[model samples]
Target: MNCEKIKGKVSIRTVLESFNLFPVKENGKTGFYFALDREEKVPSLSVDYINNKAFDFGTGKNYDIISIVQQINKTSVSDALKYLEKFNFQPQEIDQKEEVRSNAKYEIIQVKEVKHPALVQYLKYRNVCDQIHFVKEIHYQINGKKFFGIGFLNDSGGYEIRNKYTKICLGKKDVTLLKSGMDCQREVKIFEGFFDFLTYRNIQRGANEVSDYLVLNSTAMLFKAEELMKKYNIISLFLDNDSNGRLITDKLFNQYNAVRDCASIYTGFNDLNEWFCSSGRYCDY
Candidate 1:
């Protein structure tokens, strides 16, 4: 069968399950699956069964059934099609309730200090326990199920929630800009995620230099930071060592003379947190 016929016959959920991948959370026709390319504590890949498509929030990439197969198998389109030929099944139609439930709202039940043992352990695992004061213990409910996570607040009052097995946003998505409160703070450090920011703080413990911080939260929100970024004299980036990170870094460099790619500190690893967790060594800067 051709690609279009195969896509029409197979569901995104079927392709994901063929690889032993399952959703950590689901609401009606939408399910949140773990990323196909990386190992993450929380699921960041949102799969739409009704549309037979998936979107990875972490990488900001959209995938259809064929692309999802290619990503998971690291194969070409032809190879992906050949591999998918084995899973010939009819697609199921989603009902109206499931479609409406896909837009179900999540309620923030409570937000408090990070005192839960599990959350504290998660911080220690990421080597950011010392930065606990920067995050909160968030209790939220989605689809009538209670859940909690370590939440990092953004400028728009939304929380970037992370836990041992969950990663989600509680409200509107936006970049988080933190000020140093210095008389003339010109230097600002940019991180792709809050963990990297925490890792930077953990690495810079006991340092006297004061600088502002901006966490993009997601690379898709990079444009939202442009106005705020203009105020800084020095912009050091601690983005991941991936294509998306490099692309954004290059974009900033071309746009602003103050931009600096600091991923060299963790040369061989994916990001700052990965480098610290693997080597337990601190950056000299």
Candidate 2:
């Protein structure tokens, strides 16, 4: 493969090839460049030649084209290639339709079809004992699954959990069960994940009244502000007061009636799960 003499014998040909980037050579030697598909464009990293070495301006480090391409491939291949096109290189127009990709299930993993009575007991222990019990149902899907580690019954009367990279829809029955167990109607409680919801249930058992529960599996979902606002009368957001969490809460509070910040009680903790485990409050449970 022919390469461009950008600096320090850096082989542009090798870098593009490793990233599956094919180069279009002109007049056989002086000019070598590649055409990129639409999905291959990424502007995060920039390449510059200085002192005869290829330097990556984004990371502020000098790299051989091969090493740079390898690192880009590992991180986000789509974004990496766009950075390369910053030079006078031609890019190929790829149809967005072919960009089907899968990502990892970061939160939960499915081990087997094994059913454990312990999960049921754990649910009951959390004071989520509604007339309708939720049996543990586990299955696998090919698109990969998000461990979600969290889920909630939306006002639309549906259950939602995060799968590998997307949200999986739950049946209305599950949502009914969650709503039945929740004590919040006028009052509200916000939680980051399902386990925190369980923890809160366990703590609030002997308390006077139960508040409505809202589980925001990922704060990013809160961008759908209308989803939560239309359903509840008194809305309470139980979000960590950190940068991202606070950002979501502030945005929602603006359009909603009332928003409560539980982390104010213990600013040190990030979320309810962290608080349950660390805050000396729920030590008994």
Candidate 3:
């Protein structure tokens, strides 16, 4: 696609999120993100969602979506467009409707085994196809339009649905707890998201099934797992390597006795799945 078409279809927020750069604070339609080039105590990049542009107060540099990608990837315009092509984009009108009714009602259409070719490919891409039993194919509707994603069910019957293009929660957001079927399970592994949990299972190759597993689905739901976490003698955290992950790890360390941060295993990567996919260990289970 041309630069204008890409700029029109993709949002500045989406590109930042793809690089794991999240806003430290948001005000109305504008978000204050950290400067992409350097580390700082406070955010100096102002991203305008409505206009899909970003301005860096630190360097006084302005960026549209394409330029943002170019800057972050340190690539030419052609390479940047190629990188942006991997993202799934919808029409501007649909994005506007989605933003306006983000909290609107949704209906679960169906839940079945992961069978669709697209979702299967997604699982393969994440290198978690061996753990397909842990997830399902979910079809849900929002604003009378139908969509499907690989669904990981939470304890509250809600689903953490994810596809190549979208990530959302259907029903009440909550945590997912998987017991080892042992009568006296005292160990639990905590993961920030289900994909990481699946990656762990895949890496272990079914050898580490003795302990219970808890997928937070989102770190924002950490509180929901606290009461359950109290019962475990060992709590191993497989959270991301981002600022939020470090903050949550520190919080849990202060609150619990045997909390272990396992992020060191995936040291330079953002999360476990990303590490697994890039570590040249994408072998079949």
lDDT, candidate 3, 85-144, per-residue tens: 544322121221111112335799999999999999999999999999999999988768
Estimate the Cα RMSD of every predicted model relative to the unseen true structure. 12.0, 15.6, 14.5
Q: What is the lDDT of residue 183 in candidate 3?
A: 79
Write model 1 residue lDDT over 183-276, tens digit each, in one string.
7767999998899999988888899878899998766456567767888899999998875577667767877777888999999998999899
Which regions of candidate 2 are displaced past 4 Å? 1-137, 141-177, 180-185, 208-210, 225-227, 279-285
Worst 10 residues of 2 by lDDT: 96-105
Off by over 4 Å in 1: 1-104, 281-285
Q: Write the per-residue lDDT of candidate 2 for residues 55-123, one digit (tens) a residue.
A: 433445554553454455554444544433322111132221221121212233343321345433443
Per-candidate Cα lDDT values, in order, are 0.77, 0.42, 0.78
TM-score of each: 0.67, 0.43, 0.65
Superposed Cα deviation of residue 34, candidate 2 (Å): 26
Residue 176 error, candidate 2, Å: 10
